[model samples]
Target: MPEIVYAYLDVNYWHPWKIFGSISSVKQLELCLPSSKEYPVGTVFHNLVYLMLCTCETEWLNLLLCLLRDSPKLKFLRFEQYHPIRPSEERPCWSEPSSVPECVVSSLETLEWVKYEGGEEEKEAVAFILRNARCLKKATISAASTDPVKKLEMLKELSFLSRCSGTCHLTFD
Candidate 1:
């Protein structure tokens, strides 16, 4: 609906796009959903500025990039991991986009990643954002691991990566 501006969806058993796709006017949205086999590319969130996704067992980076490519005005992007990844679940992977998304180059400003584990795919996704988000102003990453050594290694790895935005402040916690 054109009148709808904010929506929070917690989907347990179904693909989220099927429901939210019809509402393109939303400005803020939060979603907690299971991983989907297919990530469609046509849903255009024309007015979306803030988006938060719960990173469950799924192709999260694929979905994030797809949304970023479509939501040209997106400014705030957040990823939250609410549950520990199971050993049996397939590890997620990231494939570089042929072209950077418009939002990352022109609009995205803030990125908050909670429960960052320094996983291969997670590092790739975070690294890609930092390198490409020209307008990014602030990025806060909170490590999920409790081990001091692991956290230090994760921080060291990410801190050396170059950022596109000169003024962007990156904080590791």
Candidate 2:
């Protein structure tokens, strides 16, 4: 079977699990959903290079972590939960992992998180990624409609966190 370079899955919109079997090498996967329910992660896209995602439900973050934990080759990850017009509203929250995923500590090189609000869970996740991702080269976080004061506070806190990679650059937008 030939390796697949791209795959898009959205249970909320389409059921394409049948086609996934033939894909031996998917390099990019995107998931768009009102995803609060768990998706089976038995199939690991080990060759995946980029992952782009969106989740609209409250339980999305935990489910997300469970799903992506096995992708050791993932280099670029983008999580979209930012609301540009409404910063005061709650964004998706990630639970502190009992053990950090290998991707966060090894293969991942760049992380782009959109609509970050600097919430408690957000801080914990950010801190974990920054401190643990040994191979990480850059992290970009964009928060829309956020208060300047809060943004600065978030920046200061993140800046002080110890990152495993000395070359990693943290950027706020």
Every candidate's CA RMSD: 1.4, 3.5
Give lDDT per model, in order: 0.87, 0.71
Query: Which residue segments of model 2 deviate by more than 4 Å?
Result: 10-24, 82-93
Q: Pick by TM-score: which candidate is best?
A: 1
Cα misplacement distance, residue 89 of candidate 1 (Å):
0.3
Over 37-101, each residue of candidate 2 has an lDDT whose tens digit, in order, gives: 44455766678779876644454576568645867788898877532323454666666778877
- Cα-based RMSD of candidate 2: 3.5
**Which residue pairs show backbone clashes in model 1?**
none
lDDT of 1 by residue, 22-59 (tens): 67789998877675555566778989999998787666
lDDT, candidate 1, at 132: 96
User: Quick one: best lDDT, which candidate?
Assistant: 1
